[model samples]
Target: MGVHTTNGIQGVSVSDDARNASARRGKKGLLIGSGVGVVALAAAAYVGACYHYKDAIPEGTTVAGKSIGGMTSEQATRQVLTLKHPNASTKANVTAGDQSFDLAPASAWKPDAEKTLDGVTEFSLSPGRLLDQINGGGEKIEPVYSVDKTALTTLVKKAAESKIDGAPKQGRVKFIGGKVSIVDGAPGHGVDEKKVADAIASGWPKKTDYTTELVEKNSDASDNAVQAFAEGDAKKAMSAPLEVSANGQSVTLTPAQVSDVISSTTGSDGKPAIKVDTEALLTTVLSRGDKMRVPAVDAKVVWKDGQPSVVEGRSGKEIDESKVAKIVGDALVGDHKATLAMKEQKPAVMAKDVNVEALPSTSMAHFESPFPTGPSQQARIHNITTAINRLNGIVVQPGEQFSLLRALGYEFTKESGYVEAGTLQGGLHLDGMGGGVSQVSTTMYNTAFFAGVQLDEHTAHAVYISRYPMGREATIWNPGIDNKWTNDTGKPILIKAHVESNKVVMDFYGTKKYDVATRTSGKYNIQSPKHRTVKNVKGCENTVGGGVPGFDVDVYRELKSGSTTVRTEKIHTKYKPDDIITCQN
Candidate 1:
């Protein structure tokens, strides 16, 4: 009986426990279902919101301060396009100095409605719109613009050009009619183009009228400034008589003369300055031949009896221009009596300072040529001797060039001490003044050639002369042909020439540097002489002038220092055939 009772109690307990477990399960299922229903409702709300605003701008969308929320992209674009922008017909007045220019505002900047609308459309599709639909905020779109920079710059430059003046001129001194005067400088005006351009670029659409003044630049010495500077000096210079004494000689400069030299000027430092015109003072008051103005004599090298001799130069005492001006200026203002400033002017070539020892002691090259003997030839010899005397003893310093024609004046008439003699004209020997001078030139050229001097200018004669070396002679004519040579011996050269018994000798005394060897390519390119007939009857003779054959030749000169050949030079010459003239009556 006890066992059965215990079993019944345990069974009842077990059944009760199972019922509690099932009730708990039922409660958990109900809570989960309720939560799922809440989630589904929230998702549906989000989807509905997205669908409602898909084709429309978010609620908070704004463009150019205009609200376009809840509108489609097309509607927003239209709204933005209708917004007010800068007017195209507006005009701006720009001023520079007294000039004014009307600028067309439309030309500088233009409003782009299509671009502005496109910007608004871009904003609508942006992720910020979604945030705007949720948070009720939007982007503020600005209007886009296009600018014509070149047109704007041109307009600004034009306005500046019309009113701009040239640059200022500095003051200077002027001497006119024995009077000292000061020329004043003038100021200039100019406009700043860049400033005007910048103003237009920044404030064009906002401001309609822009006015600017031209900048004024002051000159270095204005009228008032220069006048003040010269007033005291000029008054002092024109006050009383100025006296200057030098070397026991005295000269008194009247107030008028002093005033003539006193002037105002601008110095290198760009300041008003007082100056004295020394040239005017010297010309008006101090004569060049005055005892205080002895002329300076240059030293010279002369050939006396075929020997090089130096003529000592003499320095002359003269009034120093600058120092005299200062002393005189001070005297005019202070004491009214002053001694002139004296200075010794030294000769450019001083005897003692010259390198006479370096001069060539022995003759490096010598040339001698004989002339036809006759009374006419003697007259020609006289002229040639005169020219040689003029050139004798002339020293050619290293690197110095000598010109034969320039040394001998161009005019060969009797006034120039030249008598009629034999000359070549148009390939015919004729009597003319300065005819025998060719002999001198030919001798000098050969001498220079052997001396290794650099030949600068030289020309061969039209027809070869038997007296001169073949292919090595030169001729000179006034105003055209010239014989020139440079003294390249690195030492001074002394030229000595003499005429003796129908023969001329030219010698160059210089340091021997090179031995020159000349080679001649025998004459080529031979051309036959042409026969020319003449009708004059005075000296009727057949073949009055003999014909000469034409030919071309190349002469090569090789210069040698000791045994080594330093340089080789080629001189090419082409001679035309001499015409055979036949005289017939």
Candidate 2:
């Protein structure tokens, strides 16, 4: 009976332990199911949050201190564009020298709206950004901006121009009152434009006010250095007066004059040095030389037995400039006086060098015009003689052109030795300078016509003058009317002009290569002179001009080389009527 009772107790105990273990396992399973349900609900909440703001800016995002969180891209762009800056419109005073310029930072810098919006939208779709927003962390987006560089640069330059002076000038030697002295250089102010521009570009976007300072520049050369180098030399150069002798004449330079030629300059070593300006010193020496110099006379050609004769030329004496310069330099350096050397200057055309072989021996053309013989026409004759002498020894090379105006230098004023005489004006004879030069022109034209040369330009007289050829003549007025001819003779030509008691003759000497023959279509288209009255004003003289009939003519020139015609040219001319000009008050 005891054993059976023990067994039943053991079985009851075991059954009781199994029922407790199953109850514990059932409670654990129910807890795990509840935990899974809670995890699923949290995941669904996270996914819904991400989907809700997928196309929108995440929360807790700000740009330029403006909260743009949870806003659309367009909304954020508007916010960025309308963001107000307190100092954006503020004007800053930029001063240069004595000038001040006003600069507006707001007008120079502007915010970029699209760039700001892009930043906001890009961050909204970022996985890390979404996680951060969900975790309650916020992001600060930087605002992008655009700056007008040109406008900013212009503003800086204007400020610089107003406040800054030009660069400092170096010290130099200046001559004043026959003395040598140093002119000092000054330091200058320069603007650091790049620095100012960079500052504006950096702070302007932030709406900050700033002031830029200009840079200071110092001059490397000044009065101290110049004076130290030149003072001793200047004093030594002027210690004693300089005596210069040239061409047997002597002149003394004053102490001040000696200082005038002593100049100060910087050497290759970049230090001031003293120098003697030979050119400047020569001015004084040349003055004495001029007084003692004898001018060389060139050999002249005169017609002897209808042929050219060479007149003897004389040599002249002048100071040797190079030797004199060396002497002057020595005097300035050590000596007190200089005896200048002289040299003999030979004429360009020597009498011994000129002969018939060196000259054009054959006479190619000759023309002469008679002048009125009276005391009243003395001035006119003298004028003609002056012009002829000027044109006496002109030699034209082969294929060279000749111009009468250029030969005479085209100066027809009283200073040029032209005397007042009767000149043709408005078909009347009037007293004017260079009046009788036309006589020389007419003679030269006829000579050229017979020389078989090419005549380039010529104008006939308004009124026919009996002194000249019937259809072959030319007249000249200063600067406007000219007579030109080219030597087509393939050889050199020499012009010889002479003035006689009543006639001026012009002759061309060259190798005769062609036989020139001329034919004229006799004067036609004759028109009678018109009688007209004149109402004179101030500076008018009472005069009556004789009338002459107008006519037209054509001249043909034929060139023959050994009886074979080479070329022929036609020269046509028209003369206007000589109207009766009455000048009256």
TM-score of each: 0.41, 0.41
Q: TM-score of predicted model 1?
A: 0.41
Q: Write one digit per residue (lDDT tens) for candidate 2, span 1-585.
A: 123347456433345567788789889988998899899998777667766656466565666644556455654664566544436657655555554455665555667878766644542345676675455355777776677776776676555555455644557666444566677866666556667777777766454445556567544445676777557555455667888877677789887776677666555454665556666666655544434455455565667677777777677776676776557756765777878777886654456545555787678998889989798898888889999997897666543457787566565767678988888776666787888899999999999999887677888888888688767889987655789886655455788889976999989998765689999899999998887666654333443455778898888889887779877878887888877666666
Give the best candidate by TM-score. 1
Candidate 1: segments with Cα more than 4 A from true spot = 1-300, 303-308, 311-358, 534-545, 583-585
lDDT of 1 by residue, 62-126 (tens): 55444555445544554444444446667777766676666565666654657765533332334
Best by lDDT, which number? 2
- For model 1, what is the error of residue 578's alpha carbon versus the real structure, in angstroms, after optimal superposition? 1.9
Error of 2 at 555 (Å): 1.6
Segments of candidate 2 deviating more than 4 angstroms: 1-357, 537-546
Model 1 steric clash pairs: none
Worst 10 residues of 1 by lDDT: 119-128
Cα-based lDDT at residue 414, candidate 1 = 77
